[model samples]
Target: MDLVLDAPERTRRIHRAAARFCAANGWAPLSEVPLPNGRRADILALLPDGSFRIIEVKSCARDFLTDRKWTEYRDFCDALLFAVDADFPQALLPEDVGLICAASMEDWALLRPPPAHPLAPARRRSMLLRYAMLAGLRASAAADPEAGLLARMALRLE
Candidate 1:
């Protein structure tokens, strides 16, 4: 029997797999990260070597084809990768980007590794700070939702 998953379920699976992969590889991965260009990355991994990697999750052909902004993420990170379900057509994925086949959180494999293109020192520092702040906010929110809001407001005031 063939099994078909909807977009949201596919996305959740992809994210869970990406998160597991990142943790196992000693990288801290964040979801729905906002970039300075107003683009939000699906998964932004902070590598142990002080580099950043962005993973764009594609659930299906339509999701992959319709996104024109994925290229812009390259400017902000050292590597750009695409995470998709096992059933996704690998040939449809771009050759320039890396690929990961994720069937579930526990069953995912890296099909390709993206070439390293390190960001400039200044941009790297800026991105790192942004990542840190976002992570901190997330942690705070998890601890106390109201405190998290106040913390964000204070940061904005500064």
Candidate 2:
């Protein structure tokens, strides 16, 4: 029997595997990053070479088909990819973008490499700053749950 996970479970599993893949590859992965363009990237990673890679997570076919915003993420990163499970239909994804397939909750592999679309200098600088601020903010909040409400009102860089 095929084990069909629910949307949330699938997403969580994909996120865990994607984060691990990023770390092992020397990339810092940030989840649910709100971009300046008002797009919340599923995984926005800061590559070791100072470039960025945005990974959009697709829990299932409906998730991928309904979301067309992934196209807009190209302007903010050096490469864009979709992170999906082994069951996801690979053909539904665009060939130009990269692909990450999760074999299990703890395993992920980058199946396809993305073409380079270098970000404009100004945009890169801006994204770097925003990424830093958000990462720091999240770290602070996690380190101090008592400051939850206070941290929420600290700043809005997005």
Candidate 3:
């Protein structure tokens, strides 16, 4: 009999594997971070000293070559990582970014650092908070018209 896995179950397995891998490697990984431009990262990991890394995980039958948004995501992060379970040509990944692959926690690769700029923990935190607030504002506007109006009014008062 052929075995098949559901989407949620497969996602859970992949996430669990990633969490274990990160923990074992002494990296802290956070999932589902909201970005200012309405882009959300699947995982944001912090090195021991609090350096930031963004990881994007994909598990689809289709190839990554056709994904336009993935390229855009690489631009937003300091370091870009593509995590997958199946074998896909690493040549598709840009030379600058890193590639990580595995079926379980045992097999994972840490890609090299992004092009030199600067690594600042405080600056990253500031950026993160700003992104969070912007996302919150968007959510508020979507959920409550009164809140959105009040927010704009308060901003004008300031």
Top candidate (TM-score):
1
Kindly give the number of clashing pairs for every candidate. Answer: 0, 0, 0
CA lDDT for candidate 2: 0.89
lDDT of each: 0.89, 0.89, 0.61
lDDT of 2 by residue, 82-154 (tens): 8999889999998999999977756778899988999999999999998998888788778896674476576
Could you arrange the candidates by TM-score from highest to lowest?
Answer: 1, 2, 3
lDDT of 3 at 136: 60
TM-score of each: 0.93, 0.92, 0.62
lDDT of 2 at 51: 99
- Candidate 1 per-residue C-alpha lDDT over 38-126 given as tens digits, one digit per residue, 9 for 90 to 100: 89999999998999999999888899889889999999999999998888888988799988888787888888999889899999999
Clashing pairs in 1: none
Model 3: residues >4 Å from true position, as ranges?
6-8, 61-63, 74-76, 111-123, 128-158
Supply candidate 2's per-residue lDDT for 104: 78
- Residue 146 accuracy (lDDT) in model 2: 61
